[model samples]
Target: MQKNSSSIKSSTDILKQAIQFIGQHNITAIPINYTVSYEYCRGHHVLLRQAIDQAIVNKQPITNEAIQGWFDAFLLGYDLSELNKSHLDLNNIVDQLASTTTQAEEDVNQYDTSLKECKDELNETLDTSSLSSIVSSLLTSTTAMQIAMEQMKQQITASQCEIASLQDRLALVTIEAVTDPLTGLANRKGLSMAINESLSTALQSKNYPCLLLLDIDYFKKINDSFGHLVGDKAIKILADTLKKQLKGKDTAARYGGEEFAILLPETDLQNAWKVGENIRRVVESLRITRSNNHEEVFRMTISIGIARYQANQSINDLIELADNALYQSKNTGRNRVTIFETKL
Candidate 1:
């Protein structure tokens, strides 16, 4: 056994119940058991198992309170922590695990910042150096002063390295801006750029893409019933499902709270319907665990609205069409798919 070997085993064993529940169900689950057992349970059962198994390999012990805390933090998807810990917090032991992850990320960021600052200061020093500046100005007069020519060449080479360092830092910042801090997935801005580009291509090629808009049903009710903590688990489960169904030329966006949108490129109404039906089935079939310490399974029914792209309109038009269709699904009785048509 290794460091947290026993604890990790306990975690894996706990997830076993969740895995069994997912296996028994033909579809995926919502409000997934995002505790220790399902650490990486988003996306699918295969993912859930892999996450738990890796944690077990690390041999870490996870307390029940820590297990509960993980759900509160990760699945609940809260952007800001009240930085609050309760007096009866049953999760203090797992605090080390989360802190470790946070510290690692913080360290990497600090390193990058320090490295860039060092390079910037170096450049400033070189720029202000009388020797380098004079050498450059007098380079054309090199024959008049060969010594000066050689020194300028060296300064230029040194400056090139400093500039390269700056360029690298700029790239890192750009990537960080478009990434989801937790999941490492594209953020709303990145998703928007991608969708816009895809729409343009579809219009130019005279091919249509399907846009599906969906929201968790009675989400507010769930939150009110079982605290915001458990409500977060439900959101993560849905996010996982969206990720699983995504493919090349397909994009999924958070589309605001409890709501998600997907864009499928060069996919027509029939194929889009097939895809929509698949999503509907997967969501309805997801077996999610609830707030009770005991096993509680849940299935979510999604109301989806689909819209096709037209050269005459903008991306917003497509989104609105999909929303209308989704509204129709909800009206007809939630947990179904509706396609948009100008007629209604």
Candidate 2:
């Protein structure tokens, strides 16, 4: 009976399709930005596709912010899929290697038993011709064993090279999956991973982890006045500023458009507040200049909200607290830090 087969396009083909989709839409940003978006819509990503479609249906002028927001959501899903595939591939490779090694061992044992039988026959044979025949059989068996060993060694070497290549690809795919191409910072998926790990560690009787939510003040105005390219530059500058202020084990992530998240591991409320203040001050001190004219300088400020992790609380709970505090900062005034205080 003929076996039924299914064919699928390779990654290259998918990438080509993505490029074509981008051209059809007349998107002028970097190719990766739209390529991922294309994959998102093609894969029937419900939430992201609907988000874009809803904007169009409502006759909304689709801004870069909307596209980027939806695309970031798509990236989070892509990162998770890539991570799961990498793990599954590694597990399969390990299992196959184990099975191959076991078979090789069994073959060696069979060869050893055959050689022993040949030796016994040689000892029992009294005639010169019979003894010569036994010796010839032994030589043939030994030659076959040597060839088998060489082949096994070659197979093992090939497997090792294949494993190394897979490892390299996994690493590269993982980095790309969890990184924001614009700011070169961890995306939402990466931030979630970091938070989970830190939370797990913190639950083991260590210090609590603190979440800081930061937002760029007047970001919409900046985008509206300066064009999307300049807006992108401003976001990059803010990302850079955040990176400079964080110390060891402190992670900063691009949470969303004009919003950033910081995780301070093993930090208390006071220290977390201090870090938030420091970041705000550092950001306020920055002055970005337009490439076209050095005379044009753009100044920006940020509002931060901090909330230390509480025992038996979920990450979403912590985020809610920090978000509330962040809103308080916005309400009170811009360029300030607010801490979420729990009621006893």
Q: Which candidate number maximizes lDDT?
A: 2
- Model 1 per-residue lDDT at 170: 30
The whole-model C-alpha lDDT of candidate 2 against the native structure comes to 0.76
Name the runs in model 2 displaced over 4 angstroms. Answer: 1-82
Task: Give each model's whole-structure lDDT.
Answer: 0.62, 0.76
* Least well predicted 10-residue stretch by lDDT in candidate 1: 81-90
**Residue ranges of candidate 1 with Cα displaced over 4 Å:** 1-169, 182-185, 290-294
TM-score, one value per model = 0.52, 0.73
lDDT of 2 by residue, 1-344 (tens): 01211111233234345546555555544423554545554666777667767876897755566666766666554435534544454555555556567767887898889888987886777788888887788788778878877877876786677567657655665676678889998888778889999988889976889999999998899889988888898899889888888889888999999999999999999999999998888888888788877656578899999999888888899999999999999999889999999989
